[model samples]
Target: MAKAYWVATYRSVTDPDKLAAYAKLSGPAINAAGGRILARGLPSQVYELGLEQRTVLIEFDSVEQARAAHDSSAYQEALALLEGGAERDIRIIEGI
Candidate 1:
């Protein structure tokens, strides 16, 4: 089965308190959907200029599985906690 890789980048955070809550909620949501958090944050070089405060890398069994994890009701419940929590950009790509 082909795995799916997800790279989540955060643009801005207006609410850290809410993000903490969302993180906790999402943890279980992702686990339940058969997803593994490969990495959450790793120090990255800043050659030019970029906001590299937060980044998440996750993997799933397949692209469909990744989509299912993100689109599930459990994750939706988790996302609800982030209504005004933080701003984010997420991308899921089929990997080798």
Candidate 2:
């Protein structure tokens, strides 16, 4: 099975406190679902796009694993914590 990559490009943050709260739950949530965070908050030099923000990348065994990881109860708990914490654009892409 092809590995799946989860990417989240952040735009803006509203509440730092909530972000902290979400962070507290993220690791356990992913690990429990067999997902491992490859890199997070890494800087990207985009000379083409001419803009940048925090980009988070995670790797999963498969698309099903990726989706399952994000849809799990623990992740949902984290999501609930981050409800208004930040503004983000998130997606899961299958890696070639």
lDDT of 2 at 86: 90
Q: In candidate 1, which residue pairs get closer than 3 Å at backbone N, Cα or C atoms, i.e. clash?
A: none
Q: Per-residue lDDT for 4-89 in model 2, tens only?
A: 99898888878989988998998789888988888887475677764477778888999999999999999999989989879998
Q: Model 2, residue 85: what's the lDDT?
A: 78
Task: List model 1 lDDT by residue over 12-79, tens digit each.
Answer: 77998888889999989998999999888634664567667688999999999999999999999999
User: Each model's number of backbone clashes?
Assistant: 0, 0
**Which ten contiguous residues of candidate 1 have the minimum total lDDT?**
41-50
- TM-scores for all candidates: the values are 0.90, 0.92
lDDT of each model, Cα atoms only?
0.87, 0.86
Candidate 1's C-alpha lDDT?
0.87
Q: Candidate 2 overall Cα lDDT vs. reference?
A: 0.86
Error in Å for residue 74 of model 2: 0.6
Best by lDDT: 1
